[model samples]
Every structure is written in C-alpha cells, then in structure tokens.
Target chain A: DAGVTQSPTHLIKTRGQQVTLRCSPKSGHDTVSWYQQALGQGPQFIFQYYEEEERQRGNFPDRFSGHQFPNYSSELNVNALLLGDSALYLCASSLRTGDLMGTEAFFGQGTRLTVV
Target chain B: DQQVKQNSPSLSVQEGRISILNCDYTNSMFDYFLWYKKYPAEGPTFLISISSIKDKNEDGRFTVFLNKSAKHLSLHIVPSQPGDSAVYFCAASVAGKSTFGDGTTLTVKP
Candidate 1:
C-alpha cells in the first residue's frame, strides 16, 4: 500500500508572507496529524484532524491552522511566516478504529519549509 | 516545558558494539512510548515502540526497554553498524496527543 505522501518537497517563503503545505494520508488511514521539527529539535505536535474536523491541537499560535478534507488529505497554512518557521513540516496518519495499540502512526516524507 | 527528554545530544560507538540511547519522560500518564530514526533532510521513521505494561520488547538486533517506575526508556542496538547512525527521537502518548524528546544523534563507527 502507498504510504503517507507530502507535496512541494521543498519551499521558500518570505517573511510576512503566507504558505500552504499539503499532505495525503496513507491508504486505509483516516486520522491526520501535523508536526513541526526545527533544527536539532524533535517533532512538536501542531494539531490533529479526525472526521474532517480538528480533534486536537498543540500550543502553536493562531497563525498556524489546518484543514482536513473528506478524502483524508490535509493542508497546513502558516501566515506571516518568520525566519524561525524554517523547519520540516511533517504529516502523520493512523487508523483510529482499532485498539489504542493498533492505532500506530506512520509519517510522511515531510515538506521542508524555509522562511527567508 | 518539554515533557520528553533525551539528555545526550550525541553518541558514538564502534561497529559490532552495543549502542544504547536513553530517554526520560516527565508525564506520568503516558501509556505508550515509541522511538523513531531520522535521516538528514528526511522525516522521522518509526523504529520501535513499547507499552507501559511491558518492560522490554525485542525485534531482531534492536530492543526497547521501558521502566515505567523510573519514567525512562532505552533503545539498544546490538552489533551496531554504520547504516544505523541517525537521529533518534523518543515520543510518549498519554491521550490524543504525543510528546517528543529533543532527539539523540547516534553514530556507529565502522
């Protein structure tokens, strides 16, 4: 089965500008979660979407938002980007139906966003 | 505050030796733990996971040990190889969200 996929493998955005990154969940998975990884840091949870609605969110600012479509695809939009926004944006997918243990997450290749 | 932590920023071990990566979590409610390996300019990949009920889990030469009482976990790789070098991340899930550690860079010298 095809694994999680992310588009625009690389992108450069200017300060005060907005950028939108896309992701497609793995086949047979419904839940989509977004994460940000800065240089030499671990991935931090941005938010999660289920049933086409946001189910959970992290401590990120309001400038960061996302949307999940009926097809289980998702998009992350960051407005008024700052140089610190330059990092790897990751998308993870998991099946939420089975037991908690079975709902293991699978990550996409990730989109490298560089805010200039 | 960071809930999960990997104190060692980097580690180096000779090939064929054992490489141990350590992690600690401050959240007591975390019930699930996982380790992921990441390459340069790539996303982190799932390496292995351990549940709170089990103290240890092994798959091939890689094994994961969890000490709930200590709120610590470790990933051990036997006969470490050059290909095994990467940035290792530790994560914990208490409910709907999972928290990650800063990550450790493990290098297996060939």
Candidate 2:
C-alpha cells in the first residue's frame, strides 16, 4: 500500500551541473509521470513513461529526459541544469486504463532540487 | 497560454462555512476535470473529479460541478474544516494528460 516514493528528498547543485532524481511508483501502478513546481506555482507536467517508453511529454526541453525501468521505477536526468531548474520535482503514478479515461493519480512527496 | 485558469490566488473562509473554488479551461477537447490539494513541501493530492458526461460528482463533504458549455468547473466544500486549508489546483485532461491551473490557496479560519 506504499504510495509513490521519491529519493534524494533535497539536493543543491551549481549551475551547469547535472542531477539525477529517482522515483518508485506506487504499488499496483504502472505509469510514471514527472512534474516541476516552482515557488508559489502549481505543478507543471514534464513527461510520462509507460511500458518502459516515453508515452507523452510536455513543453520541457531536451536537457530534461527520463527512463522507466522494467520494475516500474523511474529516473529523471537534467543536463547542464540552469538556475531556473531549481524547484520541487514531483513524481506521480497512475494505472493506465485503456482509452485514457481519467484515472486517479497518486503523487510522491517530491525531490526538492536547488540549482544555485 | 495556460489552458486551465484558477483566477483566485487565495481564499479565506470561516470554519464551518461553505468554500467554493472556481476554475476555467480554454480547451473544449478536455473531457475530464480534477481538483487536487497540496501542502507545503508535499506533492498535490487528488481531491475530487468530474467527467464530461456528468455535471456533478460528490464524495462526502466535497463536491465538484462542471459546466461544459461555459468551460467552467467548481469545487464546493461544505462545513469547511481547518484540515481543508491548503493550495488547491484545478486540472483538465485528455487521454490522461492533464493541464493544471495556477492553484488557489484556501485558509479555513477558526
């Protein structure tokens, strides 16, 4: 009954450095999605992974990429991170029912990434 | 351009009162609408949702009303409690991909 879990609860890095954030989706869930939430703003979608492949992506740049392991775990990689990248990175998991009808999405506590 | 918009940044209500949160969306293709609550340092948690086929859905003290023709939806909380004070986000989705609003912070004062 464990919900989605994210690792490295908080991290600080210099601009241009790379950071890798990890996430383990909730048990019984298969789809994983990443979101970024800046101070005082709502979460913004980044990308989604299903069946070990990226099924949908938002407006994020190429510097942001992710992978979904066979075990349903996920990793978000940001290359040459910019100061603007500093935000709370959230991971959400949901069961993908056929036809894409709305399914309940459970979220993790999120990894706070600070790019100085 | 944000497809979903929550114009109110914050709202305050006396305890035991009714709380209404409004959300508007520009995308007509969106078939589902949801509301999520978030506390500081935590991810947004699902609250309630409504689909295009239905105009209203209720769960306990929380209820959502959708007006498809106006492209607007609202969340109503009756007898608001202190625990309900948090930032609420309105989202619209298609094919499971959601577009979120700017979020509204609600404070239920005792």
Candidate 3:
C-alpha cells in the first residue's frame, strides 16, 4: 500500500503570486491535513479535511485554504504569498473513527515552497 | 501563545545512553499527546502516543510519559543508537486539532 504522496517536491514562487500543492492520502484513509514547517520549527497545523469538507482549521489566515476531493486527495492553496510563506508544506493522512480524529497519521515527504 | 513548547532545541547523548526529550503545553483541554521523529528532508513519522487517561506508554526502546497536572510530556529512548539521532517533536491534540512543538534535535554519538 502506498503512503501519503505529495506533488512538486519543490517549488519557487514570487511574492503576491499564488501556489497550490497537492497530496494523495494513503489507501483506506479518509482524512487529510496540511501543515507548514518553517526553518528550525515544528510543523504548524494549517487545516484538516474530512468527507470532502473542511472539518477543522488552525490559526492560519483566510489566505490559506484547502479542498478535499471525493477521492480523499487534497490541495492546499496559498494566495498572495509572502516571503514568510517559504517553508516545507507537509500533508498527512489518517483514518477518522467516529467523531474523533485519528491518533496517528502517515505523512508525505512534503513540498518545499520558496517565496522569492 | 504557543500551546506546545519544547524548550530544548537540541540534545546530545552517547550511544547506549538514555535520551529524554521534554515538552510542555499551555492548553489544559488537550486529551491526547504524541511524539514524532523526522530526518532531514523528510516529514515527521509518528513514534508513539499516550492518551490523557494513561500516564505512560511504551514501545520497545521508546516510551512516552504524560503528566496531565503539569501539562507536560516526555519521550524516552533507551540505549540510543546513532540512527536514532533526529528531530523529535511533541504534539498535543484536542477537539480533532493537533498542535506541535518546535522540536528537539537529538544527536546520539557512537
């Protein structure tokens, strides 16, 4: 079985531009979440998607948005990127049980985003 | 305010020694805690977790201890190996959302 997979291993974007990162969850998983890991810091929760709808969100602003497709894949879009947006974007997949989130998650290698 | 805090930025230990990474959280509602390890250029991999109901959980050389009253948690690696050297992160979850610490870089010297 394949683990979580992300696209465009690395990317470079200019300020004020937009970028979209993609992720395919592990097989038999129904929930996907996105995180941002800045240099020398731990991954920060961006948001989580379940059942094709956003289920939970972190402290991120409105500029950061995400979508979950019917197939359980997800896309994270950041608009008006700033220099601080440069970081490693990680995607994690888990199997949600009832009303509780999965305790353990499988992560992808992540897409390194550089805002120039 | 940062909910989860790993005060130690890095830790060094000799092989076969014990390695302990500490973490504290400001949120009292968090009910679940976990530890994850990451290598360079790779996303963090889940190591172990303990619910609020349990004070300790062990898996092989890795053990996680939670102190709900203090809002603190720790990861212990016994007889550490060189390969175990990596960034260890402490995460806390509540209401389906999880928060992570800055991570502690552990170096096990052989």
Candidate with the greatest lDDT versus the true structure: 3
Best-to-worst ranking by lDDT: 3, 2, 1
Each candidate's lDDT (Cα)? 0.91, 0.93, 0.94
TM-score (all chains, Cα) for each model:
0.95, 0.98, 0.98
* Residue-by-residue lDDT tens digits, candidate 1, A4-85: 9999999999999999999999998899999998878899999999889998899999999999999999999999999999
Error of 3 at A73 (Å): 0.2
Evaluate model 2: give its TM-score. Answer: 0.98
Ranking of all candidate structures by their DockQ, best first: 2, 3, 1
Evaluate model 3: give its lDDT.
0.94
Docking class of 1: medium
Cα lDDT tens digits for candidate 3, B32-103: 898999999888999999998899999999999998888889999998999999999999998778899999
Candidate number that wins on TM-score, 1 or 3:
3
Q: In the order shown, what is each candidate's alpha-carbon RMSD?
A: 1.4, 0.8, 0.8
Chain B alone, TM-score of each model?
0.97, 0.98, 0.98
lDDT of 2 by residue, A1-116 (tens): 78899999999999999999999999989999999988877789999999999988999999999999999999999999999999999999999988865876999999999999
Candidate 3 lDDT score at position A9: 100
lDDT of 2 by residue, B1-110 (tens): 98999999999999999999999999999988999999877788999988899999999999999999999999999999999999999989887788889899999999
Question: For candidate 3, lDDT tens digit of each residue in A1-116?
Answer: 88999999999999999999999999999999999999998899999999999989998999999999999999999999999999999999999998665378889999999999
Q: Which 10 successive residues of model 3 chain B have the least lDDT summed?
A: B91-100
